[model samples]
Target: MVVDTEPRMLKHQVVRKSLDSLLEGMSPGDPFPSERDLADAHDVSRETLRQAIRELLVAGRIERRGRTTVVAAPKVVLPLAIGSYTEAAREKGMSATRILVGWSTYSADAELAELLHIDTGAPVVQLERVFTTDDTRVGLETTRIPADRIPGLIETFDYRTSLYAELRTRGIIFGPVVDTIETVLPDAREAALLTVDTRTPMFLLNRTSYDDQGVPIEQRRSLYRGDRMTFTAVMGA
Candidate 1:
């Protein structure tokens, strides 16, 4: 059962907690307990149970898809500091899967060449993926790694748990990223995966990640759902 802190944050904390208990680790499309059964177990009215379920749906904790309320994997955090997506998700008790869309060795296009600080025709490894939580696609990412600096990285690192963690273990440190964030319309495929309409605005984040020597190592473009996700940051002088 996913018991996030402050169930009281929503109106029906008791009912929500009960439902969370029932849905934990259950597969998508599994039958949620009947309304009467849930009401009996939680000692609440059926209307209250329905209200709690709606809140869970909004929080992306449990989906009210076709047949049942499916438990969702935990959300990911995009820290202002450097962190790995897989590590962050695992820390919150969720599994992280990386799909290697594939790699390429090609001439850099104008904008990409500028972003990666590489000469045109430089070899690059392009990685693409959709990040999921409990089988629900939450974000889409495309990352480009400059090929010269890290040859054969894909052979070992493909589908690794956390790319940034592995890089650190290899004595590679990434400096702070310079990122630009905007909201834009999702394309057809993105809309389908994110379960939103194409017209619904999605967050577009373009980031250039560098190394200690001020050499760009990774260029990344990410799209997140505005409705289902939020990011947190901390800054201090």
Candidate 2:
């Protein structure tokens, strides 16, 4: 809702920011002050406070909890495997927002060229991103796409969309992935970006996606929050 800057606008801004913080799940149901207390703190009239609360209720951002109120939304649980990040996120009704921190062509180092089965110094597009769940940052990924094969990648869609789908439309495929993961200590940048302090660790998943002809098309490294994610892998006897 585009709220106009009316005479009673400060209270609305306070409510909006507070509701957004609530949806971030910082507090479950223990945060919203009472009607009278909020009115006192914000220096607004009780009627004004009531109106702001009503707006939040209409927006579905909060609900009554016991005698008080609590945030209404929960983080989504997106299942991952076999499909692309965008695919898994979309399947679970997430918006799949991406912040493209890095996007450029690099000459593949020896290790990278070997992984993609290309000559050393072949052009590769590297993309680093943080993906969010409900506008809250949840995961970080650094991916490399071999350039000659994916030709003109930047000219096409926005960097944040489903690259796998785009590639399929161009008759390219990364058939299935072989992945491994380990619990890792977060570097400073990763910790800051993922909203985890140094004391908290992340699960680092390194994946190599291959084509039907056994060619590697993309290699990705992702760091996911340890508290928010669980992995379920089927086993073969």
Candidate 3:
């Protein structure tokens, strides 16, 4: 015997349609009505309304800021390419800004040496910066490069601008880069820098770049706010 599934499906569809209609009339960062009020207006149970809201949260249409839920800005689509983050934001019609937090030169530890293909105890330059679009903090990036590779880079180059451009001028163009992406919860320091709660999820991107001669040039670690960024990849057979 076939079971009747139309009623349950109809409830879900109706709840989704109602929420979608509500969203169409709301602007980004606008407060959403209370669940009880929305349920009453949609003539659906509270559970049904909650399920619809959960779907919207997963779709990045809404977010919880502090204690209230509000409409979310469109997720910035980050392409998987070897390019400057500033250039990427410009392509999306957004102005990108970089704030240098600090920089220093240090002796490479074993792990840093392995990542940059340098000798342990050799000098390396470490630079930290926060990336923003307009006034919204989007990401935090830390990069390490062998000091010997780019002499005077720490003193001569402006950390607020694109490092790739400066490296290009010095004939250190990138040939290939390997990227690994993972989801992580921010630590207290990271949360403070990104202006998000420690419990908020983030995307951790670790990348290593090599020069034309297969020499590792730089290793970068970037943490992007999950609520503000989405990654897209193109795959082929």
Best by lDDT: 3
In order of appearance, the predictions have TM-scores of 0.66, 0.66, 0.81
Best candidate, TM-score: 3
Cα lDDT for residue 170, candidate 3: 96
Worst 10-residue lDDT window for candidate 2 reads 57-66
* Every candidate's CA RMSD: 8.2, 13.9, 3.6
What is the model-wide C-alpha lDDT for candidate 2?
A: 0.74
Instruction: Tell me the deviation in Å of residue 54 in model 2.
Output: 35
- For model 3 the local lDDT of residue 57 reads 69
| Best-to-worst TM-score order | 3, 1, 2
Clashes of each: 0, 0, 0
The true-versus-predicted C-alpha distance at residue 42 of model 2, in Å, is 32
lDDT (Cα, tens digit) per residue for candidate 1, span 48-123: 8888876666566654455544555444555545776666766777766655455566668877888888887777
Candidate 2, after superposition: displacement of residue 31 in Å? Answer: 3.6
